[model samples]
Target: MSNKFFSVSVTNISVAILTTILISACAGNRIVNNDAPVEQLQDLNDYDSDGVIKAREKCDNTVLGASIDNYGCGNQITKMEPFKIKINFANDSFAIPDNAYDKIRVLADFLKENQEIKVVIEGHTSKVGKVNHNQTLSEQRAKAVVLVLIHDFKIPAERLDYIGYGFQRLEDERQTEEAHAANRRIMAELTHTEHLDEMEWTIYSVDQEL
Candidate 1:
């Protein structure tokens, strides 16, 4: 009767397992190409090149290379020069003042240069004449100025308007010669919205700059 025992070594088992692992690892090694979806950089492209990228650009077009703000939009501004034209007249006349050509020419040039503003030719009168007569005279006087703007200065007819104040808006209540002369006059006035160029690119300062 003999008792025989075979001792199993863990080192041999480890060696065999290591060999299997090496073979499996070698078999798993193969060239694999992954066709992944690459993101295109077109989103960052700016078509107008107005310093704002396409993703966040509000205004795409920059007019006349004008100045722009952060949102790729342009700043628009308009200014009316302290413009006024006064033409005095005789006691009962709508004729242009003798020394008013220079002012008229300047007015014409201004109207031509600035096509955005419309003007109203205002006529006033002294307190001496009848109310109805004064009103009619003032109306004629205003119309005369409007005609000058249209014919002489080439200002558009649509851009010029006429209104007469007569004795209603007398410059002076006194009947003095100087005061009467001041009252009997016509003047040009321009009124408009605060922002002249809303969507366009423009910058101006009335009486501030040329």
Candidate 2:
């Protein structure tokens, strides 16, 4: 009878030990899963500042013969002439008029055709408003054009640059409203001129107002 009791006790002990071992293994696996390092999620399809998505680009979209920097952006290999393309804005506004569409289309086409030529589109305003206010408005106008190129025309962002000069860089400085309207404009400057070293324009002096 004592032997029988001893055997039963030993069998129960073995079963308890086995259950504990199984539970410990499951706990270990849970801990490992909880502590596993998570991989950072990179959006391959997202548009970069230059409006190019690396995932879908066939060409590396990098300047040829350029060296890559620490952040993987490339160095400039060639100096291009700044091509000037100007678009006048409506009175005190940057809204694109229907008449302006064709000209914008042409500019977009030109930029698309010449992939190597980067453009700096500058926005300027007349001297009617405060200088600081004009500067901000001018920048917004330039950015508006950029949006059109990037979103509507699918122009790559790398080919575009922008700045706002406000009333500081005007073609004319007549105090009349008509002159102010004429002064408000968006203009392009090519970063690298394949054929020329520089571009020339008749920039009016901002010091004197008619």
Q: State every prediction's TM-score relative to the real structure.
A: 0.57, 0.52
Q: Candidate 1 local accuracy as lDDT?
A: 0.77
Q: Give one digit per residue, the lDDT tens place, for model 2 in 29-96.
A: 84434676777575465233333456444335444333334333544445745445456676567777
Best lDDT among the predictions, by candidate number: 1
Tell me the spans in candidate 2 whose CA falls farther than 4 Å from its real position: 1-86, 193-210
Best by TM-score: 1
In model 1, what lDDT does residue 164 have?
Answer: 92
Tens-place lDDT per residue, model 1, 1-210, is 223322346567788999999999999999678788878765777778666778878877655354667777765554444455767688898888768878788878877877788888888899986999999999999898788778877888988888998889876788799899889877777855442213333455443345
TM-score of 2: 0.52
lDDT of 2: 0.70
| CA error at residue 73 for candidate 2, angstroms | 28
Pairs of residues clashing in candidate 2? 50-157, 80-192, 80-193, 81-192, 81-193, 83-190
